[model samples]
Target: PLQLSQHRVREKEAVKQSGVKTAKVKGVKNLEEIKKAIDEIGYPSILKTCSGGYDGKGQWKLLEEKDVKSINWNENVEYILEEMIRFDKEVSCLVVRGINRDIVSYPIGENSHKKGILNKTIVPARVSKDILEKVEKTSQEIRKRLD
Candidate 1:
């Protein structure tokens, strides 16, 4: 659980292996690797620390070739370059598992972010029933894989 929570690359790999769709991501260790990944993934992508970053603290958006030069790369810290995903709304579902292996999920919530910080969440997200079911199912799948 700790590993899955801390390592973004590992978590994404596990989710991908679990048959969940995710944005294209590449793990990079330095500027050179980041450049290579950018070439492969293309522009308008994001660079984020692999661990210990919260509330959008360790993130950089490379909107174009010139944007890459603006980041102060740290060779010592690992990073993940991800293709930027555009979406209309952001929703999240929380799943809890008990010691006896019983699992339950809360209703999906619509999330709003301000300057990359989570602002508020509205429970019972205003989404189609089909989308809600899919989100719950995806959350369950992730929980199973992480467990």
Candidate 2:
């Protein structure tokens, strides 16, 4: 659980194992690796610390070649270069598992972010029923995998 919560790369790997689609990602240990990952992932990508970052901190958006030069790269810290995906809306599902291993999922929620911070979340996200069901199933799958 700590591994999943603290490491973005590990978390994304878990998500992928659960059959959820995720942005293309590659882990890097230094600036040279980051440049190589950017070349592979292409422009409009995001660089994020592998661990210990919250809210909007420890992230940089490399929209173009010039944007890469603006980052204050730290060679010691591990990072992940992820393909930036543009989406219509952001939604989430909360799933909880009891001590006895019983699992339950709440209704899907629509999330709105402001300046990289979560501003609001509306319950019963304004999405189709099929999409909501899929999200819930995916959430449960992720929770199960975490166990």
Candidate 3:
């Protein structure tokens, strides 16, 4: 379950291995390093712990340089900075596979986030057929490779 356990790593590595373009990211060990990385990544970047974080528990949104100074750092933890993505919409694709390798995918679900926490999910997300297909295909590819 390495892929699933590494919540943040899977996102980056899946997009990379699948040849899908994703946000740029960097890992940092301290506040100073993060500030420097942000300068290169620009404002509106995301700062997240590399592991053991989920549901907005260990994430910070940096909309500006001043936001960096406000961070309360823990010397023992690692953090990652990611460029904020400007998306037309947010969606999640879920796939279920049995022990026999039979797989089924659910309709893409549109997602809403409030302060980086998933606020709502709507099935059969309102989108063009093409977008839905792309989402499912990508999800399936990831599942296959991980499996």
Compare the candidates by lDDT and give the number of the best one.
1
Query: Which scores better on TM-score, 1 or 2?
Result: 1
**Prediction 2 TM-score vs. true:** 0.92
Cα deviation of 90, candidate 1, in Å: 0.8
Displacement of the residue 25 alpha carbon in candidate 1, Å: 0.2
Consecutive 10-residue window with the lowest summed lDDT within model 3: 1-10
Clashes of each: 0, 0, 0
lDDT of 2 by residue, 41-131 (tens): 9989988999977776798888998888898888889899999999998998877777998877888899998887789999889999888
Model 3 residue 109 distance off true place after TM-score fit, in angstroms: 0.4
Which prediction has more favorable lDDT, 1 or 3?
1
- Each candidate structure's TM-score, on Cα atoms with residue i matched to residue i, is 0.96, 0.92, 0.87
Per-residue lDDT of model 3, residues 1-147, tens digit only = 465447675567666676666788877889778978887898889899888888788988899878888889998987889999999889998788879978888889999888778999988898999999889888877777666
The sequence of per-residue lDDT tens digits that candidate 1 reaches over residues 1-147 is: 778779889989999988899999999998889889998999899999999887778998889988888988888899999999999999999999889988889889999998888899999999999999999989988888778
lDDT by candidate, in order shown = 0.91, 0.86, 0.82
